[model samples]
Target: MNHALAQAVRLAPVVEKVHGAHHPELTRVRELTQALADTTDDARIDGYYAELRAVTDNYTVPEDACEGFTSHYRALQESEQFWQNR
Candidate 1:
């Protein structure tokens, strides 16, 4: 498992325990992210990133990471959008 993927795995339980896993989109995202964290290659991460991107198309994650993976990914998404649209 990749180090970043390990972080992603840690993030998932935090997500579930604190935020519940009722939303399908987030459920899919978390599952994929868990898989993402379990992977051990570039191609695998890339593939999972695509799956995650698809699941996240219109979704905005809750801002309750208190400085963790969710916050980081959310910030990364917003930064990319800013750059992409700038």
Candidate 2:
């Protein structure tokens, strides 16, 4: 998750540069990414997951998910493992 957050921080500006600052999805990603990057506390991380759940309904991947969707969920699951060990 920390790595993902760092990547988000690194990529958001590039995304905005190409997609424009007003692009809503990228903007939201930036906000969430920044929030995650700003902390290492377990409680705070849990809170971020709460917020993410509110946004993504527990990261529900549909049955008909595309490759990207599957990869995203897989990454999140790995992130959870990483966080647990940290």
Candidate 3:
């Protein structure tokens, strides 16, 4: 995996804890990150990118969110940029 993806993976659990497992935002992030991490197929990768574009809108930090949550979103955004540039 690339560095941004790896960083997002490493930060995911902490973000989940901060945002709570049941949060919709966390669910999408976890699923997308895991899917990308687990797949090498081109079709699946294309699909993942489509979904990721939609999901990126949710990666913003809410006014009331914690520092860890903000960091998590930053990592995710970086990961998205990495993939988009590839």
Candidate 4:
């Protein structure tokens, strides 16, 4: 968990760069990432990650977004073992 966490963290630095309402969300991400890195409970980590991803990816898929979520979700699952296991 610790090994790959840094890369996952580096993906969302924009939230922290700006000081505004978004700060709280990034702060929570930091807190949750820490908890996730420290946690060993499968259910806890899985539940937290699932909730986090759902909230972070709140954008709706436009009809003409060029692709369906199934493909995206499949790719995500294939590359991320944690997601695949789910």
Badly placed stretches (over 4 Å) of model 2 are: 1-30
Q: What is candidate 3's TM-score against the reference?
A: 0.75
In the range 1-86, model 1's lDDT, one tens digit per residue, is: 43444555666566655555454465666687666555657677567676667766633565443455365356435433443354
TM-score of each: 0.54, 0.50, 0.75, 0.49
Q: For residue 62, give model 1's deviation from the true position in Å.
A: 5.0
User: What lDDT would each prediction earn against the true structure?
Assistant: 0.56, 0.56, 0.73, 0.47
Better of 1 and 4 by lDDT: 1
Ranking of candidates on lDDT, top first: 3, 2, 1, 4
Which ranges of candidate 4 are over 4 A from the true structure?
Answer: 9-23, 58-86
Writing each residue's lDDT as its tens digit, candidate 4 over 1-86 gives 44345444443343334422533555555455556666778788777667556644632332432233323323233324554454
- Once fitted onto the true fold, the runs of candidate 1 whose alpha carbons sit more than 4 angstroms away are 1-4, 62-72, 75-86
Of the candidates numbered 2 and 3, which has the greater lDDT value?
3
Worst 10 residues of 2 by lDDT: 18-27
Kindly report which residue pairs in candidate 1 clash with one another.
Answer: 5-37
lDDT of 2 by residue, 8-86 (tens): 4666556545444343444554466567677877798777656655654565655654555445545444555566677
lDDT of 3 at 19: 72
User: Mind sharing the TM-score for model 1?
Assistant: 0.54
